[model samples]
Target: MARPRKPLLSRARIVAAAAALVDAEGLEAVSTRRLAAGLGVSGPSLYNHFRTKDEILEAVADAVSAQVDLSMFDESDARDWRTALHDWALSYRAALTDHPNIVPVLARGPGRRPAGLRVADAVFGAMVRAGWPPAQATYIGALMRYFITGSALGSFARGFVDDETAYDPADYPHLGQAHLLAERREKVDEGAFETGLRALLDGLALQYAAVVPDAHAAAGTER
Candidate 1:
């Protein structure tokens, strides 16, 4: 007789296995049979947790989103909100780079998951704590998410392209200049992300800090 199977399969474990597969291979390798085989189980076993591969993929995306750590933003920092926000965005970019294959899936739509909401709340909460109005905080946080995620996906995808492609430098002189700078710098360096994040956060901080004239006056005197 065949040995009995372990009844330990759960949605979480299935998603984890799928994420691991995608991390090792690309997203194309994360089919139902592949996942089941990877877990040393039958295909039907996964059906017990997820109805379809899409569901499994969704779960995996959620699992990855859940992995982002936001503890550093929990306490009040003596640094300005611009510094704090830049750190948060940089940390988020680092986490995204660790799992490039799944970042595209995440970039598509994981917006409604609990983990996704928590990340939004954390960012908005930081802005709120820094004296931004509710509306401004929410808007800026969402904008920051779009900017950071889109930039990361674009940069990672471009890594597959050839380094020596010829282009008409005369037609797009600025882009050619940027290409030169890009070639000189490290490929994985996130200077663009950091620069953009700091500039936007600084603008937001300045706008919000204006509401506190007394604080601004005191800060000016110190400066």
Candidate 2:
């Protein structure tokens, strides 16, 4: 019998399968045995590509990181750091939002993941090139990651049940309309992200001015 043209398993296929599993059933649902069954192969077959489940999960997380758009960091575009950072944060949050289950692993930092490292490198390098000190640039990278991942961890609006009685006026006087939040989850969550992003960028702009005295004038011109 001739062998199959397409191999039954490969590293990319395993990572994709693992990512799908994580997306559908959360990270805990992924195991070598589980992935093997899903891929129609024996459990041992996965070891040929990944040494352990953790390695597979790392690949999946890095794959999610690869989805983030880093184009805004292109120096040739000449975009102010504030604008670039804002756009990058939005893109990062979007990638994490789509794979909320993997945020936990990602929150642990880039580790040795190639794509994850690229994200960190881009943010740090962009900040430095934009006139931010190296130490502060590092802090900026960490800060953005924390904020974006925290935002993706869960939905604030969805936390409130749709039941109007969930927020009793007697117990929660200020949350009179809290019950309506869940129905407008998309709008509320997106608005919250934008509001937070703007606030972050505004604060950073002040810091940038202090570090680079001409930052205000340059920012005004960019605007």
Clashing pairs in 1: none
TM-score of each: 0.76, 0.95
Q: What residue runs in model 2 are displaced by over 4 Å at the alpha carbon?
A: 1-6, 215-217, 220-223
- Estimate the lDDT of model 1: 0.70
Tens digit of per-residue lDDT, candidate 2, span 132-179: 899999999999988999999899999999998878899999999999
Error of 1 at 215 (Å): 5.9
Candidate number of the best TM-score:
2
Best by lDDT: 2
lDDT of 2 at 53: 95
- Candidate 1, residues 14-116: lDDT per residue as tens digits? 8888988988997898899988887889999888888999877777777767777776568655645566666677777777777778787778745677777
Q: CA lDDT, every prediction?
A: 0.70, 0.89
Candidate 1: where is the Cα deviation over 4 Å? 1-7, 75-79, 108-110, 156-189, 211-223
Residue 165 local lDDT, model 1: 44
